[model samples]
Target: MKNTTDKQLLRRATAVHRDMLKQAEKFGVSASQYDVTKLLHTSESGKVKVLIDATERLAIAIAKRRRIIICEK
Candidate 1:
């Protein structure tokens, strides 16, 4: 059961990461701007937390960029 739980967590993390990357691309944010190398060595829970934090940061950046673009127009 623990193994199954771990797998689920990993899957969720991967999905979140993929979505975050797609959103970043849409906003013209380079993937290289975020450091994900450490994720591989982190625990499953840690990976999720890190990814969630990164996603929130990306969302904020995208919002700011949109506001700037709207103001420029």
Candidate 2:
């Protein structure tokens, strides 16, 4: 199997984030564009995968009117 580059992983994560944002907006919330440097240096999997995952989870919480902290890069 080919190794997935960090950039590629981040791209995929961003797509997930975008979808999360749409859901979040319905709850009157939004997301921030995390700095590239922070993402690049993120401690998880050489990309911001966990961050996006957390964002998705946060969106779910937002939809349910639950309060959650966003982990910005």
Report lDDT (CA) for all predictions.
Answer: 0.68, 0.57
**The best candidate in terms of TM-score:** 1
Residue 73, model 2: Cα distance from true site in angstroms: 36
Q: Model 2, range 3-72, lDDT digits (tens) per residue?
A: 5676676777767766776666665564454223345454655356566666656666675553434342
- By lDDT, the best candidate is 1
The superposed Cα distance between candidate 1 and the true structure at residue 64, in angstroms, equals 1.2
Model 2 weakest lDDT span, ten residues long: 64-73
Tens digits of lDDT, candidate 1, 29-59: 7755564635656553476667767767777
RMSD of candidate 1 to true structure, Å: 2.7
Residue 15 Cα positional deviation in candidate 1, in Å, after optimal superposition: 1.4
Residue pairs in steric clash, candidate 1?
Answer: none
Cα RMSD of all models vs. native, in order, equals 2.7, 8.1
